[model samples]
Each structure stands twice: as structure tokens, then as C-alpha cells.
Target: MADPLALTPKSSYAELPLRIVSAILIAPPAVAAIWLGTPYIEMVVLAAVFMMAVEWARLVGHDRNPWLIGAMTAGAPQPVIGYFFGGFDIAAILTAILFLAMLVMAKIAKLPRGLWLAAGIPVIVLPAISLLFIRNDPMGVQTALWLVAVIAATDIGAYFSGRTIGGPKLAPRISPKKTWAGLIGGMLSAALVGTATILLIGEGDIPLIAVVSAIMAVVAQMGDLSESAVKRHFGVKDSGAIIPGHGGLFDRLDGFITSLPTIALATALSGASVLQWH
Candidate 1:
């Protein structure tokens, strides 16, 4: 697909300024919520998840009425709420039931894009729930901060390195601009930020943090590429115009959506403090 920004010529680089401004506006409040914990974080997560659902629906060609979009978005948070009240078991059951109901509803209503709609449940809810789980842990604050830092470092490093190097494409078919250099740069940056953050503020084996950070960096990039594939499949440039330059909440949070759940699962299985080595 052709680059959307390229079509505008004069405004091709306009996205950079808008992206910077949006990040400045969003980061502070997000950090505050992570620090504040619970209700605040939960609310913020729900809101983001809802927006992502809407954007997902829009990307899949379901843009008739705003109410229908809103209804589709509503399902993303149900499982998260279930997890909060009942635990993972209940959350799992709820997710299954919800998925089946959505499939049936789509079939009955004859929604053309039912599969993607059904997919929104797990795609959006799992990460949101993972974030909640991480933030509710004893070392919640540190873990949340670590996750944010790693993601930010990965994105920033990849952006600059890819632009500067501009060599081989990481995945030419999916995201032409991404490069192997960018991937390595992102992983290194994540390792550095994650290792330093845990060492200074919390406790952990530095090597373990570095390794996990590197892995999460790769996962985050994969998340980005996956989103890009979705856009390419639908032949749309941006998911939505919700964020000035960032495209949409999904565009902005795709990395977090994938990485958080992976990290959360790692933490769960290892029984380690997210900031500390087992």
C-alpha cells in the first residue's frame, strides 16, 4: 500500500511534530495513573481498550453507526472486570463465553466482519488484564515503570536508528521502513533502560532484566508489524484519526498490548518479582 503521509507532500513530516506533542500530552497522565494504581489505572485502561476496539472495528470496515462501534468496544473490558472480581479462572470462562456469544450474535445479525469483531475480545482484553495484574502486584509501581520505560526506549531507539541507518528492511512486505538495525537498536535500548531502571529503583539481576527487555522489545516490534499487516489487509492507512499523528490508540499502544501480556505470563510462571530475578 502507498504511504498515506506521502500523498500530502507538504505535510509528510507534519506527523513528527504532532507525534511529539501527543506523546508529551499523553505520557504524564499515563505515568501518573501507573503510580496512582487501581481505580485510576483501571479506568484509563478501560478507556484505551474501548478506543482500540472502535479503531479495530473501523479498520475492518464496520463504520455504519457510532452506537454499533461503541457496542463492539464494550466487550473488550468485560473480561478484565471478571478477572478483577473473580480471578483468572472466571476471567478465562468469561472470555470464552463472550467470544462464543459474539460469534453467534454476528452470525444472527449477518455482520460481514464477524471474525475480527470476535477477535477484539482477546486481543484487547488480555493485555488490559495483564496490565492490571502487574499493577496490582506488591512491586506493582516498579514493574509498571519498567514496562513503560522499555517500550519507550524501544520505540525511540528504533525510530532514530532506522532513519539513520536505512539499510535492509526488517519485513519489507509488512512494514517497509522497519530495519534490522532498528530492531537491534530497539532491543539494546530496551535492555539498557530496563536494566538501569530496575537496578536504581528496585531489585533484580541485571542480566535477567536485560534479557527480558530484549525479548519484550522484539515482541513489541512484532506487535507493531502485526498491526501494520492488519492495516495492509484492509488497505487503510491509519486505524483512525483519533490521535493527531499517532493514527489511533491501537497505533500508539500496540507494543504495550503484546508485551504486557507476555511479561505478565513470564512473571506468573516464574513467580519472580517483575523487577527481580527469580
Candidate 2:
């Protein structure tokens, strides 16, 4: 029987060039920033998060007034910046107050879809905070690289595996293209990448690294699915036309946004050197 989920050979052939080109253009700078760490990665995360806020606003109909959307986007990174100066406890409190105030204001203004308008806070702030925290750790650069490797492997594996061995859809209603085979492939690839990264960086528990990597891969897929759900709810095809084949920064970084916070949390709780895992 024909595989209903499979993309036509011709269609796959047509998209391959564009996908490859887009990946080539995007991967180098991102990897460079991860390697450099600190201020550079911080800046990159801030800009990307702000762009994601803009895209979210646009999707949820909050961008009709350019100035309002612009202000909101510009302000999205304030909490993370606060973290830099005021520390996490104070920054967390301030962020909560700020988000509450924004929500109250949205209600007062009778904004359309006030809930989603409020959602723009965590959508940008949490991940920005997470990335900043992770990159500020003692073994920050290595930790960041491990994250990048896992995410990259998951995305690459899913893309190729899904395209080549398409079968049952993972979530037909949310993202029709994702498949069970692709999910398994992504998890396996993430595990492999994590193991390799740990070994390359020095000694570590390979089993623990693989387990963590697999969990992250699953979370990344969940993040992607959540974003897809949002887009579908808004009745839009893409978040924005910024990236050539990727749609928008949000579209590209959705998995990262979700994964970073979890990684950061685990790193903190475990109190292990993320690089050494010791």
C-alpha cells in the first residue's frame, strides 16, 4: 500500500535545495555565537526573542498598530536584562509584576484576544532568561554547545528520516508532516550527538547524557507542535516571511525556546558542571 503520509518524490526534490541553502546560511553564525558565549550569545538570544515577540504579536492580531507592537517587542527582553543587573530573584518578581500589569492593561484596553496578548510575555522572556542563565554558568560555552548539538541533530534527523521513511503521522491535526519514524530517528540522533559531545569535551557518563538528550528531543518536538498549534489557530501558514525557507525566528527557534528552560533547570538542580557532568 502507498504511504499516505509520504511527500511526493517530486515535491521533496523541489524543497531540498531551498532547505539546504537555508540551513547553510543559518547554522554557521549560530554555532559561532554558541562557541563565543557570554555577551555575544546573550545579544543573539535577545534579538531572536524580540523578533519572536513581534511575530507572535503579528499572528495574534496585536500588530495592527505598528508602534504598540514595536514597543512590546522592544520591551520583551527587559526581564532578562534585569536578571543581568538585579539577579534572578528580584528579576523574577519584577517580571511577574510587569506581566500582570501588561495583562491588566490589555484588559482595560479591551484588546482582541487578550489572553494571547498576555502570552507574549513567557513566549519571549522565559527562554531568554534560560539562555542567559545557561550561558553564564562556569562551563557555559560547552553546555551551550551540547544544547546546540542535540537540537541540531534532532532537527536534521527528523527532516531526513521523515522525508525518506514517511509512514504514520505523529500529529495529523497539528502538524501533518511529522511522523512516528521521524520522532524515533530524532531521539536516536539526539542521544548520539549528546554522547559524542560529552566524550569530545572530556569524560562524562554517556548513559546519562543520552537519556537527557532523548528527553530534550521529545521536549523540542512538543515545542514545535505547540507552535504549529498556535499558527493553525491563527489560520496562518507561516509566522513571518523573514527567513527564506524557515518562515520566522519563532518558527526556527521554537524548539530552542522550550528546551533551554528545561536544560537550565536541570543544570541548576543537578549542580553538576554542565560541561564535565561531574
Q: Please write out the lDDT profile of model 1 over residues 21-59, one tens digit for every residue.
A: 667867888899999987899888888778777887888
lDDT of 2 by residue, 114-197 (tens): 778777887778887887788778887788778888987888777777777877788889888778877888889899998898
Q: Global CA lDDT of candidate 1, please?
A: 0.78
Residue pairs in candidate 1 whose N, alpha carbon or C atoms collide under 3 angstroms: none
The backbone clash count of each candidate, in order, is: 0, 0
Candidate 2 regions exceeding 4 Å error are 1-13
What TM-score would every model get versus the actual structure? 0.91, 0.91
